[model samples]
Target: MTDLRVGIGSLKLKNPVMTASGTAGYGAELAEFFDPSLLGALVMKGISLEPWQGNPPPRITETPCGMINSIGLQNVGLEMFLREKLPFARQWDVPVIANILGTSADEYVRLAAELDGAGVEGIELNVSCPNIKKGGISFGRDMAVFARLVGAVRKTVKSAALIVKLTPDAPVAEFARAAEESGADAVSLINSIPAMAIDVNTRRPLVKNVIGGLSGPAVKPIAVRMVYQASRAVRVPVIGMGGITEGRDAVEFMLAGAHAVAVGTAIFSDPMAPLKILDGIRAYMENHGIKRVSAITGSVRT
Candidate 1:
């Protein structure tokens, strides 16, 4: 057997395969399919200081080789998640990672502080959400704004590891370095490329938000390039995601310097995609005579 375990700061994973937040829900629904603990880590959907109803109807649209979604960070409020969901997640042996977002720096601080010591392995800051306080600008698009948000959360949270999830709209390496400078433990990248789709007959957009985050195989190559760049730019671990539906794809990400990989849109097609990816990774390692999964991270030959 091959060694599949890896670490992100103080958080350890049985393997480098994790489920993307918002795709796997809070882990209850996925628990019905398999043991949620079997995954390296279970990243829950994005949570906020308050409940979000999300965008209007037609929030998701299927595109070629991928899909676009404008879920608008809809999730149960933090208090309710602590009251109801955290207990259930504690039952599993896997580490639970909270995916959090906020419209303001204060809100982000409050959310991180609440999740601190809340039995979670870490917190992934979903920076793709629009900052309503700043005239509807994305927090991740600006390096200064991104660093400020991360710094606020860093001061508030003491126990859980901080993982900043970056948007593809900006240079990911710059954002990753900014997160590190602000005390982030690790960074996850290629959240989703901003994109849009339209209906020719009505001459209107298919998605209600008009523009949404795109994810799937279409973004995999771009994700790989970003992961490689960001990993080189920072000493922290990089969790790569975007269109990873097979084991070979996951291995490609690791080669690009991702310490771990997350499955997002692929789950919409196959609930057991993460497990399949894990199995494939193990097989690839065995075939290549590789022992530790970490050995391949950033081993890409240019």
Candidate 2:
């Protein structure tokens, strides 16, 4: 029998396929497509210390083989998530990981502490967000700032597994290592890369925010490479994302050194993408004569 179970620190998942944050809004949004329990975990939309209205309209724009968005981490505050989303999430057999974003150490600590006791299986710290307290620079872009942020979050979060979601602006190896060293249970990498698009006809920006994060097939190679670097740099498990649309993509990540993978923009096109990826992974394992999914990690050759 094939074994698909995987782990990130003490957090054990039935399989390695999880929905990326923002793509899977609290799980309920995708219920029509597949049972939430079928997934290893669900990373809901980014939740902040307080509610966010998100950026202005034209937030999403299509690019060749990908898309760009500056959704501005829009989400209900932690309180609403607990009052509304948590109850529904508790019914799912799969682990629920809250993706929390903050602009400062105080906000990070507060959100982490709240989610730690909110019955979530894990907390994914989105350190890539703009820090309002620091002139809007991303915390993950600087090693020193990243380390201090993680250290603060680590001190506040007690029981929930800490998974640091890294930004692509910095060296993933160093950033991931810093997270692991600062008490992260695991690290996920290759958050959307900074990009922009324009309307030549209208002479306006394609997305409302002028600049947005690029995601989809165009980012796959970079994400895979970063996953390899981060995995090699740290002892903790590495969760890879970016431009994953099918099972083959997931397999590529696993072979590149990712212990687990997340599906994001692909979800917008096919709600069943995660399920299909799961099946594809199993088929790939069988074809390779590998019984356990873990065997695929770091199996890539130069």
Q: Write the per-residue lDDT of candidate 2 for residues 1-302, one digit (tens) a residue.
A: 78999998778999999999999999997997778999999998999978999999899999999999999888999999999998888787999999999889789889989998877889999988878888999999878888999999999888778999999989889999999999999999789999999999999999989999999999999999999999999999999999999889999999999999999999998999999999999999888899999999999998
TM-score of each: 0.98, 0.99
Worst 10 residues of 2 by lDDT: 127-136
Shift in Å, residue 204, candidate 2: 0.6
List of clashing residue pairs for candidate 1: 216-243
Q: Provide the global lDDT of candidate 1 against the true structure.
A: 0.92
Model 1, 1-302: lDDT tens digits are 68899999989999999999999999998888999889999999999989999999799989999999988888998988999988889989998999998888888888898898675889999887778888878899988888999998999889898999989899888999999999999999888888999999998898998988899999999999999999999999999998999999999999999999999898899999999999999999999999999998999996
Local distance difference test, per candidate? 0.92, 0.92
